[model samples]
Target: MLRRSAVILVATLAAVAGAVSPASAGGPRHVRGTETIPVYDYGTAIRETVWVESPLDSDGDGARDRIAADIVRPREARTRVPVVMEASPYYACCGRGNESELKEYAADGTVSLMPLYYDNYFVPRGYAFVGVDLSGTARSTGCEDVGGPAEVASAKAVIDWLNGRGTAFDASGARVTASWTTGKVGMIGKSWDGSVANGVAATGVRGLETIVPIGAISSWYDYQRYNGILRTREYVRYLHSYVNGRPAEACADELAAMRAASGETTGDFTAHWAERDYRTAARNVRASVFIAHGVNDKNVSTGQFGLWWDALAKHGVERKLWLFQAGHEDPFDVRRAEWVRTLHRWFDHELHGLRNGIDREPRATLETAPGVWTDERDWPARGVRDRSLPLGDGTLGAGAKGRGVTKTFTDESLREDALVANPTAVVPGRVAFLSAPLTAPLRISGEPSVTLRIQVDKPTAALSARLVDYGTGTRVDHFRSEGVVNLATESCWGAATATDDACYLDTTEVTATADHAVLTRGWADAAHYRSLRFTTPLEPGRWYDVTVPLNTYDVTVPAGHVLGLVIGQSDPQFTVTNDQNATVTLDAGRSTLTLPATGAAVTAPTTPQSITTTTLPGAAERRATDNTPVVPLR
Candidate 1:
């Protein structure tokens, strides 16, 4: 697709076909390729540091903010090549990659080491690798706004400087320009790093060609707030406090502003949240997106990617998606070889101008199950449709035929582990319904919703639902570090030097045996069921129609396993927003559970059992769990 002479195209094709030209040949400027022969010595690679100026004065110093950027490039290149950049706050605080490696500086104020494998692998292959310390993190001059305008603009300013539209200064306070490289750029990162890439891409910067956001957040509001419920209060302030390089008091006012504007107490969507949401600006994106996410991610949540993908589709943006069976993890850790291979082809096709057929391939690659991957033309599996199942006395019926019986349960400060135990037995704080053991496999490819016609005894009550797959099976134990463990042995990916190496310790999946797995969950405030922007206080003892949407999922329930629906007060795993302990009564005939289902039609549910006081083996823990849930380390 590139406009070039036949000789140049054939040379590039030869490089793409694995017969990379010798190092003597001009690296990328003469022949476009990122996976080409090593044309530069990494030991002698040029390392430079710069501060890019932004439009805002986020740190209140009466001067424009400047973002710190570290660059590593091939010293042999005489002509312009492309760039692969990562803008992150983790370079100094949380570090990056499996080992949490932080940036190491040389005594001369130059970069002694670039963290992660990007510089070691790509710099010698012709791409300049730039690592930027986001605003308020590391050496950058600004306050961390969690994905607000200041953080986003700080990243965009670096890209602007690359495109000759912004100002940048060297360590010696002399102005510097990116005259040695082409303006085309690609951004890549994980978690908060990826979240920043999403924000910058949403700005439609002129020089940005593509982005690879791994386990990133698309909306900060959705990150800590699910539906109308607050997952954790003041999460933004906590994140800011962690990333800021200044003293606690130096950034105290900024953190205070974040908490005051976040509406954590009311759990409402306000203009403050809108400023951090990238989906609203998806239409402005000119760069292509390649998203990688853990289907069971709880830190950022899986809903972030689903809604962002939908919005990208709405705007006809070119994109590709990879859904894995982990939580808050990087594909590089889950699928290393494939990750490197595809990313090579992707960067080549987008940045290096290689005429690869990646664009013509399937748009989605999903790990349908453990070690099972499939490529599909579209997501939601193409034939997926919403299936409505009625809530029976103690069963999930296939049709709208349910006895006119009412069920009651009281609100309790129970965690997800306690609320889902012994689903068939009697429990005071939660009510559950079960479907027949499946004769065939049933898969759900998207979000699920639960509707209840209930009357609460208090002014406000917490509404929570869990979709569980009930069967003894092997599944990713996300509670144990996002389904991976770093081993002692290591594998090399690219070139190495005396100080920096491309080799990293390998990782493998973490799985465990389980009787029941919670596929997805949802929660909402009964008072905010009407709208997320404002609260409509409920009248005690009055029936209200409330619907809560569970987090997105793509999972299959095997034969001989039953689908279970557990309705409870809240999952203290995220947070217990309400502590009213009020009683709730619901009409079974009017309540229903809707799933994004495909495969097998259910005609009836297995008969019900009488409610008893019997509980699981750990009766005390099943009734009221005292063990705390693991918080994500991101």
Candidate 2:
């Protein structure tokens, strides 16, 4: 054994040696006060705040509106970097993510706990993260115009300021210029926040290179009504109150004006809704987009995403997609690690001009189940053939010989479950039809359409069609009519701070083992069959050919399963069942259901197979009745 003094000296010398040693042999180093420090530290990010000027007097105030922005950047960014922005109204009202984090301000009005994990994850990666408060929200000065010009302009102005074309101010009210930026910008958000991104991109503003809008609304009209049928009567008033969160009297005038101009009584696509339609201005989009949406989202409707995606494709805009089966959810919660990595590469390729192979990769990523994901070269996978299945004599088949055979149903007193149950059983107020058990797996990858030739006693009636799978298996219970249950367990994603933490406990994604699963559904009014912008009521007892377009979906029906189409005159979930009960007759010879089929060629059976009469237990209730706005955090 060595002496105590010798042992102490040896330990002291080893501690000093370890303290001065570099973490890695060839790591990047920075000289600080005669010492060498490793330069790649991810925890040292700079957080600050500023206000960009907007040329909008939406509040009817004399002064122009100013948008408050919270910024975070890498501490060692010696040169200018590109920007990633999220402009939203929820930072003040509903907060963000499953935990609902609000913005925390310092004594001097500087932002502290910025909402989502964008700043916490991206700032350390040599990118600047910006959280912008929309005009009239939080510390910004103006009236929130929802999707109007004022809201769109407020976001565009921030991009302009970064590119040296607009103005911003510091905390002391002094004008400041974004001299530390490369003028490249990318915006990402969900719900209303994503709507702002879409609206701003539709303006073709300079410096807005890309956007990632998750579960966003492209048309405001579709949110409140469906094809001339009023659904949510007080959508505007409800949304205004939900976003503002201030004293109702403060914005009483604005709210009243919004309700008056909404055209709710007529349920028409008036000029007010026209201004809020991003599809009309899609030709002006110059930014590449990455779109993500839940196919089962009743709040923002999958139709909005389908229409916007189609419009962007027609305009030849570069785009990508992430379609899922959840309802009103963010992709981050569903696929966190992959989402973060994919998003990082997308921003780098679009904003930093990095030659990442993201653009060359598959254009679509679809989630089939809770932990199942698949990639495709493009959405609505190529080589889809439309198969027309006829509806006649209580059977859905490929051929219909019974011309005079007719099924009648009234426009009152029927639930969706009762309509889709036991097709062979006699059900009043609705008609149900089902195909024979599929010989092989059938995959549907696009929208399904319904063509009905009918004569009705009333001038107008609500039409609903549901595509269902009748078999015993486990699948995603998409129609969670009674919302999701949040468990006590918690999960952490990205970095966490005292004021704002990127932690969330996953909510439930309803699953069930039953006789059938509602694949997709569609609704329309008979009077608006020809045109949604205009309506012409039908003459009583006159034959009319009406086609209703159903929601888009991608699902694979297992072998031995039967495809079903349930047609009903009214669905109490959406439109109130027409009070005046009217008898409707269907012409079997002309009625057919068109499905976009994928995989092996399937010929519909000429002879109708025996219909299965199994009743699925626990029928899902209807969602979308409530007007409470859900701000999705992506």
Candidate 3:
């Protein structure tokens, strides 16, 4: 496993070291106004397949891997077109886009059908679309390691080949140069495809002009774990096995190696996780990044986007963000027309070197309501300030209430809705705190955190915290994985052919009118409260501090709504709990909950959870912790 990880790291370093500046071939071109227009025929677009050599031999077959690139370009484009690329493991397996489009080959061995709308819409707009199969998936070679180094290098190799830094061979075993392209590239996709774009751009690879990562993961560890809490076991093996369509016997060792190295049980921040985390590589990003994510996405949490966004900002990278209310979805489905036009202008400005003013626009777009969007200067609402309200017996306020009160609960797994129902009641496994109704609308713009001084009768427990909004309103039904339901009708964006089309089934938002909604929540292991990278055993009855971070979000609670916080044990929906059966006690006087808000103050009464009628069900909650400054948990 160590040798395999080393191979990946070494291959990545070599690929980046050999990179050079992008160049143009200088051929016929056409344009209208400030943007490139659809001046070429889509049906007559050139389709071909090429295999670019990879640097990693992940299969240990004594040969380096080969990556398959499927291209669709306008026949009219001799050399003037830039490229839009998508590297993925799903082309042959899970498929791509909302309709699950797959590739079909012609008798001449060229691609007769290219999957997504990129080939249809952008090829006619003077942009070539290159869909590269991830190594070990589809027609590509080597073992697929999920978001590991081999997969990353394979995608970057495509960018290198486009810029004349690497070599490729066409269908006839003939060497082919990318003289047909200007070497300006923009990578875009959703889910794992988007994650590949992120990894490639993080390499500081030359010729990668920009990237659009929608509903993508920034860290593989965060994908399966939350702060030290493992959400699922053996996902490394499951995902790699799922994506690799090759015979199982071929990559068995590769899969086993990944599972062993992933720290699937301990849930610690091990070397395997550090290697897949992109935040540490944010400084290497040279391309402009336009990121899109759903605040409610469960497949890939918002923390992946939030932490990555923060790291990029600190490095002074050119970036923009779009946060929606849907779960694990694409913004195109939410606002199709605006998204297409906005994406078109973004590519034009970044890849074509046009002055489209996209970079000068506001840096953030957030969906404040079910269908309403707002442009903001930055995320977490620009002027967000950290406001800490001390936890009381039943109230949260500046004035201390519950000075000597101690609250106890047994560490047991329970559904969040059941624990939060009628928040004022004395639930067996959870505690609740609520603030008074707000006088003005409050917009929570950044990550919310909680601190608790707790004592457990056992060595460890799973600590969960939730932030909720208490009021009736129309909200995105995040529990529904499909943010939008597809309809029978279709809408076209570009020209179509017999095998492929530029149109897709129309979709509408799926929403629910509810009295409350869980905005964000987080979970952590009590033993790992001190360090997400390491664990410290408790003395059983001694007090220890723990900090749990809720996923990042941007939402406005109306003036009439009340803010509530619920502290509980294991949340069955998202976590695999220790089931320690330990009795946990929280010191109310020393605990604090900090939030970022635009307008409005927070106040609450004492003893809401201890009393039934006084508490509000489906209440707001953040997190809890002890006295020590827990480093790197968030």
Candidate 4:
């Protein structure tokens, strides 16, 4: 990764070196916007620390809150240039990037180790880079509201300062302004940091020309719950501590307030969650968006990005996407050179108003596997068709059942691995249905859904659908690893500072060659089958047609691979414990599994212990704690 970046950097340097004037001191000239600005040398860029004032006082401190910004910009610029900013709460705690590098404060109270390679790579390219510490984090004041208005406003305030609409101060408390910036900013980050960009963009902040949210959260509600089913009852509280890194006592009131606001008890979409949901305000977004997400991201999940992308499209917002087959990870790790070059061009077009023709390219780029990427006009590719496969006697077919058949499973405690392991295994806690080995490859490009027509014995039941690809093949092992192993040797991607090195260990992790891979999964509370904000309990002996929507995915199933759909009550690895072990009776005649298959046909045949139709008794319906600054791998 470093070697590739070095090559790109060397080329970039050569281009800039030729542009330098012979009479100029150490300044290089680059044509951006309407001016030929004197760019500061990469090795001698100005690094400074300042505090940008924010409008919120979330911590309730006597004074107004401030955001800590570590900025690197061209020292010899005669005029303002564009700015690249990253706002994050993780800097003071879990650090940033795959290496988990933290902020280092010099004895003079200036900062070093400014997270990722953004500053190292962009500062010399004639852009001012600002690494902002979100409120109540690192050197900033106020509390972290996760993705609420306070956090959004804190970051927005920095942009305002750069545009001369807000105030900033130096170490001596002297007023400072971003006179070196053109007031056009491009925000980029992964996970929570990226979410900040999403949140701020939804507010339609003026100076923010574009944003790149990689593995970012579009809705905090989705991050903690799925279709009204709680993914983790304590995730918000856990995240509060995880990002703060301070003693619990320091932010007791803030944490308490966050837990109460989450409303995990009912898993409803309250106004509190609404404040953190960017999709609800997507129409107000003025910035062009470049989104990247891992299709197999279990942490922030792909649904967040998909829903946000859809919203942006609906509002006619210019957008682009990079959908990878990896888990919660930054594209810089997966596609280093290409990611950097594309991102550079994207910023140039958006912030500098350069006619790079990037907006004319394909709207989406998808990775079928590691090292295999393809471009599409849009996501859920235009010509894909929904292939409806009905449940038959141990088979998936297009024909309706002649008689009512019921498949039952107890809502016993079981993990995802146990539920998806074997196609022939008649698991006590779940029911598995498989399609016949595909005669040809089929690519699934969008959300898949299942309709279960059933009557439950109890009032509530948790429904989990696992879309599995059962075959011996080398697939993207997103569930088990970061997919990269650290190499012993080191290399550099950007220019380095004395205390903050721009080099990271060149690493690689091989994709797992496994017999089976869990392609996509989704879960919902039967009560939430109606609406996420409202719960409707089931009436005993009465049939309810429940539609469970699975996660969004982009994958091509290999020929001869058996596509299987496993439905059950609980995944012990993901959801909170629910003790409602209700027997679920499925009317196979009325039930159907809908999938977005790229090709035309889909079929299934009977195997031992496979689903078969007949009148049957109704059965029961079911269902990383580490203090190590665990890297958000996806």
All models: lDDT? Answer: 0.80, 0.74, 0.79, 0.77
| Better-scoring candidate (TM-score), 2 or 3 | 3
lDDT of 3 by residue, 1-634 (tens): 0112333433432342222222223423545545666657767888989999888888889988889999998997755689999998988887777777788788987887777677767787789999999999999889898899999999999999999998899878798888889999999989888888889888999999999999888898888777787776666777787789678987999888888887777888888888888889999999988999989876677888888888998999999888888877888777887788888889989887878788889988888888898898877686789889888875665664868988999966667667666776667888877887777988888788888889998878889998888777888776654467787875665555666665677787778777777788888888888787887878787999898888887888999787788898877667765545778999988888889877887877433333233232322321121111111100
**What is the TM-score of candidate 4?**
0.90
Off by over 4 Å in 4: 1-28, 32-39, 245-250, 400-403, 606-634
Tens-digit lDDT track of model 4 for 1-634: 2333545555544453344444334433555443233345655678799999998777776677888899888787666789999998887777788788777776877665677788876776678899898877778888777788778999999999988999999989999988788899999999999999999999998899999999999998888787777776677776766677444575688878888877778777777788999998999999999999889887777888988998999999999999887778888877776787788789878887767788899989888777788999888887778888898654565543415678877787566666776666677888777777788888888888999888888887888888988777765555445455566875555555555546766655357676777788888888777778778888989989888888888888888877888888866666764635878877776788999888635675644444222211111111132111223423
TM-scores, all models, native as reference: 0.92, 0.88, 0.91, 0.90
What does the lDDT come to for candidate 3?
0.79
**lDDT score, candidate 2:** 0.74
lDDT of 1 at 593: 90
- On residues 413-524, what C-alpha lDDT tens digit does candidate 2 reach at each position? 4666667777667778778776767888888977788999988888777788889888878665555532244667644434434454445565666666777767787877
Query: What's the lDDT of the predicted structure labeled candidate 1?
Result: 0.80
Q: Which ten residues in a row have the lowest lDDT in candidate 3?
A: 625-634
